[model samples]
Target: MGQLLDGKLVAASLKEETLQQANELREKGIVPKLTIVRVGAQPSDLAYERGALKRMAACNIDVEVKELDAEITQEDFVKELKAVNEDPATHGILIFRPLPKQLDENAIQYVIAPEKDVDCFSPINVAKMNVGDKTGLTPCTPTAVMEILRHYEINPTGKDCVVIGASNVVGRPVFELLLNEMATVTICHIETKDSSKWARQAEILVVGVGVPRLVKENWVSEGTIVVDVGINVDKEGKMCGDVDFDNIVDKASMITPVPGGVGSVTTSVLAKHVVKACKQQNGL
Candidate 1:
C-alpha cells in the first residue's frame, strides 16, 4: 500500500499554529483581518469563500467578504480595492479570480497593495518569489506544497524534482520554491518531448497540468514521492488528479490523493499568510 500524504491532517496542524498566532495578536490588541473581494456568484468561488471564512473563524481571525455584483464596472472594482488597501484594519486582501468578462483582471490585481496582497497574485510578490525572497507571501498553493513536504519530513534539497506544468499559480512558483531549497528542478509543459524521461529521473514529482490522469504509472520511478496538484472532473463526473492514482500508488513511496490532498491545505495556508502580513504590518 502506498503511504498517503494526508493533507487534511497536515492542514489541521498548520491551522492550530495559525490560531496560536491569532491569539497572540489579539492579546496585543491587534486583530488580524482578511477581506475577500468576490466578483460573482460562481459556485466554485462561493464554495471557496465559504471554506475560507470558516477557517478564519476557527483561527480567531477577523474576516469580511465583499460580494460584488457580476455587472460591477472595472473602475468601481478598483475603487473598492483602493478602500481596502487604505484600511488599517484590513491586513490581508484576496480577490477571487476569473472576474466578469468586461472587467480587466490584470488592472484589478495591480491595484491591491503589495503588503496586503496575501494571495500573492500581484506583480510585486511575483518578482519577490522569482528572486527567492522568503519574506514575501508566496502563492498559497505552492506554499502548501512546500508545507506538505515539510510535514512529511521530505526535504527537497539537492534532489532531482520534476514539476509537470508551468502555470503561474502552481507549476512555476513551485519550481522556483523547490530551487530555493537547492533542488535540481525541471519544469515540463504540454509541448515537452518525452516528458516521462524527466519524471522517471526525479526523486520528487509534482503534477499540476489540470488534466485528469495525465501522469501514468510508467512515468514515475519506484520510491518517488508524488504530489498531485491537479483537480479535474472526469467524464464520469468524478473528481480526480492529474496522476493516475490507482495505477501509480503501488510504484510510489508516497502520494497525495486529489480531493483530500493539496486542496485541503490551500485555504489554511492563505490564512497563515494573513497572519504573516499582520505581523509585518505591526512590525512584530
Candidate 2:
C-alpha cells in the first residue's frame, strides 16, 4: 500500500492556525467575516454553504448565507453582489457557482470586487495569479493542492508533472502554480489524443478530469505521486475520484484519496483566505 496523504489532518492544523489568527485580529478590533451568496435551493449549493459555514465557525470567523430566489433576474443578482463587495465589514465574498440559467455567469463574476473575491473567480484575480502576484487570492482547490504538497514536503521543482483537466478552477491554476515552482508541466484536457502517454511519463500526476476512475494504474509510472481532485459517485453510489485508487495505490509512492483528501482541505483553505483578507483589510 502507498502512503496516504490525509487532508483531514492537514486541514485541522490549518484551521487551528486560522483560529489563532482570528483571535489575534479580534484583539485588534478586527472581525473577519465571510459572506456566501447562494442563489436558489440547489442541493449541492446548500450543502456546500452549510459546510463552509461550519468551517468558518471553527476558525472563529463570522459567516452569513444570503439565499436568493431562483427566479432572481440578472440585474438583481449583480446588485446583491455589489452590495456584498462594497461592504467593509464583509472581508470575503463567495458566490456559489452554476447560478440559475436565467442569469449571466460572466457578468455576475465581473460584479465582484477583486479585494473581497475570496473564491478568486473574478477575472482580475485570475489575471493577477497568471502574473505571479502574491497580492491576489487564488482559487481555494488549487491553493489547497499546494498546501497539501507543502504539508508533505513535496517539492515540484525540476519534476515532470502532468495535470489532467484544464478548467479555470482546478487544472489551469494548478498548472500555473506548478510552473511557478519551476516544474516541467504538461496540461492535458479531454480533447487530448493520448492523455495516458503523458501521464505515464510524469513524476507527479494531478488528476481533476471529473470523470470517475478515468486514470488507472497503467497510466502512471512507478513511484509517481498522484493527487486525485475529482469527486464523482461510482456505480455503487460511493464517492470516488478520477484516479482508480485500488489499482494505483500499489504502484504510486504517495496518493490522496477522494473523500479524505483534497475535498477535506477546500473549506479550510476558504477560511484561511478569509483570515488573510481580513488581515489585509485591517492593515494588520
Candidate 3:
C-alpha cells in the first residue's frame, strides 16, 4: 500500500507557523482579523465556517461572521460587501460562494478589496495567481494540495503531472501551481479525448472533477503520486474522493484520502492567508 499523505499533520504544522506569525504581529500591536460573509445557512457552508472559526481561533486571529438573509437583494449584498471592503480593521475577507439566485457573483466578485480577499475571490488576485505572483492570496484548496505535497517532500519539478478537471477554483490553479514548480503539467476536462491515457502518463495525478471514484486502478501507474481534491457523495450517500482509493492504493506510491486529505488542510491555508494579508496590509 502507498504511504498515506496525512493532511492533519500538515495542517497542524501550518497552524503552528501561522500562530507564530500572528503572535509576532500581535507584538507589533497588530491583530489579524478575518471577516466571513455567508448568505443563508448552507449545511456545507456552516460546516466550513465551524472549521475556519476553529482554525483562526487557534492561530490567535479574530473572526467576524456576517450572516445575511437567504433572499438578500444584489444591491444590499453589494452594499454589505463594500462596507466590509472599506473596513480598515478587517485584514481578510472570505465569502461563501454560490450566493442566492438573485445575487449574481460576477456583479459582486470585485466588491471585496483585493488586499483583504483571502480566498482569491477578486479578479486581481486571480490574475496575480495566474501569473505566479507570490504576493497574491491563492484559493485555499489548491494551496492545501501543495502543502500536502510539500509536507510529504514530493517535489513536482520536471515531473509529468496530470490534473483532471479544469475548474477555476481547484484544477486550473493547481495546474498553474505545479507548473510554477517547473513541473510539466497537462490539464484534462470533460471534453478532453483519451483522458485516461493522460492519467496513465502522470507521475503526479490530481483529480478534482467532483466525480466520486472516477479514477480506477488502471488509470494510474505504479509509484504515481495521487492527490484527490474532490469531495462528493457516492450513490450510496457515502463520502468518497475522485480516485477509487481502495483499488488504486497499491498502485500509487503516495495518495491522499478524501476526508483526511486536502479538505483538512484548507482551513489552515485560510488561516495562513489571513495572517499574510494582515502583515501585508500593515506594511510588516
Worst 10 residues of 1 by lDDT: 102-111
Q: Predictions ranked by lDDT, top down?
A: 3, 1, 2
Ranking by TM-score: 1, 3, 2
What TM-score would each prediction reach against the true structure?
0.98, 0.97, 0.98
- Tell me the tens digit of each residue's lDDT in model 2 across 123-241: 98888888878888899999888888888999999999999999988999999888888889999998999999999999889999899999988998899999989999999999999
Model 1 stretches astray by more than 4 angstroms: none
The alpha-carbon deviation from the true structure for residue 107 of candidate 2, after best TM-score superposition, in angstroms, is 1.3
State each candidate's clash count.
Answer: 0, 0, 0
Local error of candidate 1 at 67, Å? Answer: 1.0
Scored by Cα lDDT, where does model 1 land? 0.93
lDDT of 3 by residue, 193-243 (tens): 888999999999999999989999989999999999999999999999999
Off by over 4 Å in 2: none
In model 3, the worst 10-residue window by lDDT is 103-112
- Model 3 stretches astray by more than 4 angstroms: none
- By summed lDDT, the worst window of 10 consecutive residues in model 2 runs over 106-115
